[model samples]
Target chain A: MQTPASFEYERATSVEGAIASLQRLGSGARIIAGGHSLLPMMKLRLANPEHLIDINDLAELSYIREQGDELSIGALTRHVELEKSELLARHFPLFRDAENVIADPVVRNRGTIGGSLCQADAAEDLSAVCSAVKAKAVIRGAGGERVVGMEDFHIGPYVTAVGEGEMLTEVRIPLRPGGGSAHEKVERRAGDWAIAAASAAVWIEGGKIADVGVALGAVGPTTIHLSRAEELLRGKAPSEGLFAQAGEIASADCSPSADGRGPIDYKRHLASVLTTRALSRATARALHQEA
Target chain B: MHVSISVNGEQVSREIEPRQLLVHFIRETPDLTGTHWGCDTSNCGACVVQMDGQPVKSCTILAAMCEGHEIRTVESLEVDGQLDPIQMGFHEQHALQCGFCTPGMLMTARALLDENPNPTDLEIRTAISGGICRCTGYKNIVSAVRWAAEYEAAAKQEV
Candidate 1:
C-alpha cells in the first residue's frame, strides 16, 4: 500500500554516464543513492520524480582520502563506512560521533553520505556535522562542477543548492592543525531524528581558539550556523567561561519551533546546553587530553 | 521491466513494475514469505534481507535496483534438514512470541555474527537496533544471538 507511483528506473554504469542521463532526463529525473531517505518520501507520494537514475553502481564515487590539506569524501560512501573509517575518526571524530547515532545500523548499511547531505533534512545529523566542520560540497552538473561551502550549500529545509541536471559528487573538509570537532545529539529514542543537536569544531593555536564553527540541527529551517558563537569563541582562551558565553549566544541566536519533539523553549535550551558540551569536548580533544 | 536477481542462491527472473520493492519481489517471485513485510517504511526491520552479504531493508530498495545482485532471505538459513545455528538458538532461547519480528532479527543477528564473531550485549542490542518487536522480546533475542555465536565457535573448533 505504500509503494511509490510508477516510474522508470535505469542504472548508471559510470559517473559520466550518470551525468549524461541526468542531462537527458531533465528535471523530472532524480538520482537515487542508498534510497533509504528518498524511497520513503516517494512511498508517501511526497517526491514524485518520474525517472530514477540509480547511482549504486558508480563505484568511482565511493572514496575517502586526504587530498593535500583536505579530506575528500566521495558521495557514494555509505554511512557504515563513514562510521568506522579510521581516517575520519583520526581527523574529525565528529563524523563518527554523528554517524553512530544517525540511524540504525541496518539503515546505515544502505544509506549514503551524499544521500543524507542532499536530503538536507533539518533534523538530520550530517548537515550539522558538515556545517560545524566547515565542509564544502561539490555539485557536478552537465556544464561542470561547482564547490559551495556549507553556508551556501544549504538553501532551506529539505532544499539544497544542487540544481537541475546536477548531482553532488563529494564533500571536502579542510585539514587544519590543532583542530578538533565534536557532535552531540539528543533523540527521543534510538535511531530517531535529533530532538536538538549541536555540532562544534574548534581549532586551537598558541593556546587560543583560532577558529571555530558551531552549528545546530532540528532547531531551525536550516542547520543553524552559530556565526555569533564562532565569532565570540575565536581569538579567546579555551576556558569554560568562554564556552558558557558561546552557549548563551547559541541560545539567543538559534530559532527552534515547537512540535512533537518538544516546546520551543526546550529546544532553545538544548541548543545552548549541547553547544556548550560539544565545545568542551572539542577543546579537550584539541588539547590532546582525551581520545 | 524484466529483472533477474539471485534470490536465496537461485536465479529468479520476473517482470515487475518499476515501483515494486525488493521485499515484494522476494515474497511474490520465489514465494519467500519468510521475509516478513512490516511498516512498509524502512523503520521496521521486518523486511531485512542479505543483499550481497549486507543486511539491507528490502522495503526501501527497488527491485529494479537489485538486478543481478545476490539476495539471501530467511529461507536460505537452513541447510538440508538442519536449521541454521541461529534458528536453533532462537528456538532454544524463546527469542520470539508472536514471531513477527523473528525473520528480520535473525537475519540482522546473522549479519552481525558474520562481521563480528563475538559481540557484547550492548553490541548485539546495537546491531538489532533497527528491528522492533511489539512483544519487546529483546532480552531473549540477545541471548539467542549469543547462543548461536557460542554454537558456531564450538562447531568450528570441532572441525
Candidate 2:
C-alpha cells in the first residue's frame, strides 16, 4: 500500500471553524464529511490535499425537518436515514425510493446526501432526484450562505458550483400543495450506478396537472431537466399519449454516451421508457392526492 | 496524527500518518489479521467493519476520522471461546472455501442481522452485495444468514 505524504488533520468543532481551517490550509485544504466519495478519489490518486478538515462531528447538520412549507434535510443526513425517514416517505417519497436503490446497504450506511451531491457523479441517483424535486442546495461559504437551485448546482460531469472552502449545509425541498412523486431507474445490477434514471413530481389540481418537474440521470454530463417533457405534462390531463410524447421529447433532449453498460441509442430508449414509467407512476400518485 | 479507536473491544491508539486508512490501522496497528483488504477503492467490502455499530468500508474511511468511534472486526465476533452467530453459521453451513471474503461477509451479515433480524432472501443478498466472494458463490453465504436467523429465532423462543 502506498502511504500518502505527510498531511495535517483538523477536526472542526463548528462549520465556522471548518471554514477558518480550510482558509488556513489555503488551496490544499479539503473538507471531509462522510468520506465516501472524497476518500476513494484520494486513494485512486485522483485527489490529494495537504490538509483534511474533518466535519463529521458537526451534529447539527444531520436532520430531516419540515420547516415552513419545505422539507429541510441537513447535508450530513446519511442515505440510510433517508431510506427509513417517515417524513421523507410522506412528503418526498421519491427521494426515499431513490435512496433505497443507491449503492448497497454498507454504502448507504456511510454515504451522505451532501457527499453524493458534492461528489457530483453523473451516474449518482440523488442528484437527478434533487433536480426532479426542484430542491435548493443551501451552501455556506466564507462569504455567507446562498441557496443554489438544483438545476444550477451542477455545471458539468463531476463538477458543481461548490467553490473553495464552501460547505453544503442543507437541502430544502418544497412541500407542494398536491405533492405526489415517483422515481424509476434501470441499472446493470442491483446496486450499481444507473444506466439512466428518471424522477417525476407533479402537482395536480381539479383534474389538471398544475406544475410538474422531470429530471434525468446518467443521460448527460450533468443531471438534466427535461423541460420539453415537463412542459408537455404541465396543465395536461396526464394521459398516456401525453406521457408518450413527453418520453419522446426526453429521449431526444438527452445526450447519453455509448458506455460499457449499453449503447447510446439503447440508453435513449431507456430514457423514454423509464421516463414514461416514472411519470405514469407519479401521475397516479398525484391523482390519488387530488382524490 | 494520533488516533484512538476501540477495536475488537480494545481501545487501541496509534500515531500514524494522515493517509493511513482505517483498514490499515486495524490490520497493522492492532495486528488483527482477520480484516482483509482486497480492493482498496471501497468497491469490495473486504475491509468492512462495524464503525460505531454501522458497517462501513474501512478502506474509504480515514483512520483519523475514527478517533472516538468503536470498531468491530472479525476477530471481535467471538465471545468466551464461542463463535458469534455469523461465524458459527458460516462454519456450520459451509459458507467459506478460501476464507478470504469470510471476515467481510461475516461483519456485513452481523451489521445486517443486528438491525434487521428477519431480513428476506433478497434483503440478505442486498445486505452483502458490497462484498465479493470468488469462491463460495454466495449460495452458502445466503444459507448461512438464513440459518443464523433461524438459530436466533429458536434461541429466542427457548428463552
Candidate 3:
C-alpha cells in the first residue's frame, strides 16, 4: 500500500524545458531521472515534492564520452551503461567496480548517476567513487550551468548542491596520465547498501605517488574525503607499508554510527581494510601491473 | 491524471492518481494481476515487469512516469496458448514453491534471456539478484533460467 502523496507530473521535452518547469514550480518541484531513488523515497513519504518534472525523455543528456582532457558523463546516463562502458572501464575501472555492486542488474537498468548522486545517501557508492576521482558535477538551472567539486556537491545526508530550479547535468573527471582507480565495498547481502566502501584513485610519477584521492562511503554523514589519508600517501612510493599506514588514517578519520549493517567499530575496521585493498589495486593498475 | 501506456503491446489508458505505481496500474487498469505487488519497496522483485524490453521494478515506478512506454507484464509471456520458454522452463524445473515470486522471476528471466540468449549460471544468478524468494527456491529458479537459455539457443539454431 506504499504510495507517494498526490503531486502534479510533467514530462520535460528538453533540458531547458525541465529547468523551466522547476523554476516555475519553485522549491516544491523535483526533477526525476530514472526515478529509482526518488520514487522509493516518495513511497515511504520521506520525500514529498509538490511537482515532479520527468527528465527521462531528455535523451540528449545521456552519454559518456571524452571531451578535451576530461571524461564527461551525462547525468542521465543509466547505471547499466556505466557498468558496460568500455570507455569507462579503460579509463576509470572504479566506475565499473562500483556499478557492478551498486544494486542488482535489474535496478541498475533504471537508475541514473545524476539521481544517485543527488539523492546523496551516505551508503550509496557512486558519490564516494566520484569523490575519489576528483570528479566535478555540472549543475544546470534556468539561469545557467555551474560546476562544483564533489567535496562541495553534497551539503548533507539526502542533500545536494543542486538547487530549487537546478539539476545535475553531467560529471567531469579530469583525465590524468599515470592514473588508475579502484573501488571496494562490503555489503550484507545482494543489492544491499554498503556497510563501508572505499574508492581510491592514484597517479604515479617517477615511481612515486604524485597524487591520490581516497574516499569512504557509509562511514559518515556524507562521503568522507579522507584528506588525512591522501596527504599520507602523497609523495610516498607504492608499497604495502605505505598503504597500511594510509588505512590507519582512514580507520581513524571516518565517523560511522551503529545500525543494522554493523557496529561503529566494525564499520571503522571495514573502512580501513577496504581502503588498503582499493589503494593496493589502484596503485597496481597505475603501474600497469594488473588490469 | 490521465495516463496512457502500452501494456503487452496494447494501449491502456486510465485516469489514475499521479502517485499510483505502475504495478497497481497494470493490475487495476488492464486487470493483469499476474504482476504481483510485494515488498511495496523495491527490494522484492515481485513487482517486476519489462519496460521497453528491459526489466524494471514496477513498484518503484510511478504510472505517470510510464506514460508512452511499452510495458510487458507476466501475462504477455503466453501468446496463442504457447508459454514462453522461460515459463515452460519454470514448469519443468518446479521453480516455484508458493508461486508468489514466479511472475517476477519469469519476467526477469525472460528479459535476461532476450538480452543474453546464453547466460551462465553465474550470469543468471547475477541477473535475478534483485529478486528474493521467501521460499528460498533460487536453486530451481536458476536452473529454470538456464533451461530456458538452452531451449532458446537450440530453438534459434534450428531456425
Q: Rank the candidates by DockQ, best first.
A: 1, 3, 2
Cα lDDT tens digits for candidate 2, A145-170: 99999988998888888888788899
Model 3: how far residue A17 lies from native, Å:
1.1
lDDT of 3 by residue, B50-111 (tens): 99999999998888998888999999999999999999999999889999988999999999
Each candidate's lDDT (Cα)? 0.93, 0.87, 0.93
Interface RMSD of 1: 0.6
Error of 1 at B51 (Å): 0.5
lDDT per residue (tens digit) for residues B47-66 in model 2 = 89999888888888889888
DockQ for each model: 0.94, 0.72, 0.89
Give lDDT for model 3: 0.93
Query: Chain B TM-score for each model?
Result: 0.97, 0.96, 0.97
Q: Pick the candidate with the highest DockQ.
A: 1
Supply the global lDDT for candidate 1.
0.93
